[model samples]
Target: MSLPLPLIFDYEEIAGKFYPVIPIELKVNEKRFLTRAYVDSGATFSIFNAEIADYLGLDYRKGDKIYPAGIGGHICAYIKDIFISIHNIEICCEVLFSDEFTVKFNLLGRAGIFDRFRVCFDDSEKKLYLYEKAYSDFR
Candidate 1:
């Protein structure tokens, strides 16, 4: 059986817009882990704070420089590949790595997850729905 879609919520109203936390899982090397991450559609790439990366034991190295919005001006980060999971659905994708000292939470950007899933937000129900396009027609 396929996994059910996850509920979405308005980021602004829920987490004051700075950090819109979404419940999801991170899968790596065939292992699945659960964590709540911030959904940042504005971000061109996904990111994981240092703590989360270390916790997952991801062997990541410094990649090309990336400029991300920060409290001051823009913050620089590195890139790496990680398996991300949501509602039991897992997909390995490239992600940015940064120290938690700069960012408040882990960010889920538009690159990987949003590319494959159709997202719907129900304001009335305060839930966000994520549907895999590949499985949309399957009954």
Candidate 2:
């Protein structure tokens, strides 16, 4: 029902913050590699680092183009269907990738990943709960 959220601590900043990160496996051309991604409920689209696009054999610029802006500023990215594996469950998800995307962190947003799973984040317990939902459940 509840799973521990992978977190990292930083002491360089005056006030340290807890980052909810998870190890997700990316599958491309049947090749698999493990990577870390931040779970964000507020993000409109999930985005990954450019290196992953290369590893996945994606050109990163030829797909559908979209300019997304936020507090970090504007970034140009291409939308592509990416295969992601988490907790032994695999899903084909739409993700944005760009050379300018920060290589330091990958984001798992609310669109593709949230469509299939019910997510609950509890700061008190520092846990993320995920439940699979059937097609009929949403209707």
Candidate 3:
């Protein structure tokens, strides 16, 4: 099935440019938080601010630890399974929570999402096409 997601136009003062952001709901058991996240194909794993995990009352540090590096430097993060709702489609996946990731937006990356859907970014239309793959499609 093909699901087209409408992106929210977010303007960044530093870049003076607008980018497409996706609205997602993060949930841990009974707790749920709605927020916008950058759909980044370059990122290996979905990463969220530690504050979000705290908001969900998660003991984030108990998860596996890893140091993910970027242009700025490496930062500590913990991997944990959480449910993400995109367009009301809920999926449980592993994500990283970090205190040092101070970016303005959370990231929906390759690990969990890309593995399940074929993502097409239509920059001109400012939208994302998420095509859900059947089990046979996985090689």
Off by over 4 Å in 3: 1-16, 135-139
The lDDT values for all models are 0.68, 0.76, 0.82
* Backbone clash pairs in model 3 (N, Cα, C under 3 Å; residues 3+ apart or in different chains), count: 0
* Minimal lDDT window, size 10, model 2: 6-15
Taking all chains together, each candidate's TM-score versus the true structure is: 0.72, 0.82, 0.84
Error of 1 at 129 (Å): 1.5
Q: Over the full model, what C-alpha lDDT does candidate 2 score relative to the true structure?
A: 0.76
Cα lDDT tens digits, model 1, 1-65, are 67555545544454343335677787667565687776766778888776666777765555665
| Sequence-dependent TM-score of model 3 | 0.84
Q: How accurate is candidate 1 locally (lDDT)?
A: 0.68
- Root-mean-square deviation of each candidate, in angstroms? 4.9, 4.7, 3.3
Ten residues in a row with the worst lDDT in model 3? 5-14
The best candidate in terms of TM-score: 3
> How would you encode candidate 2's per-residue C-alpha lDDT over 1-139 as one tens digit per residue?
4533432322121136656677789887777779878788888888988888888777768789999787889989989887888877788888899788864778888877888777777665656667766666644
Instruction: For residue 100, give model 2's deviation from the true position in Å.
Output: 1.0
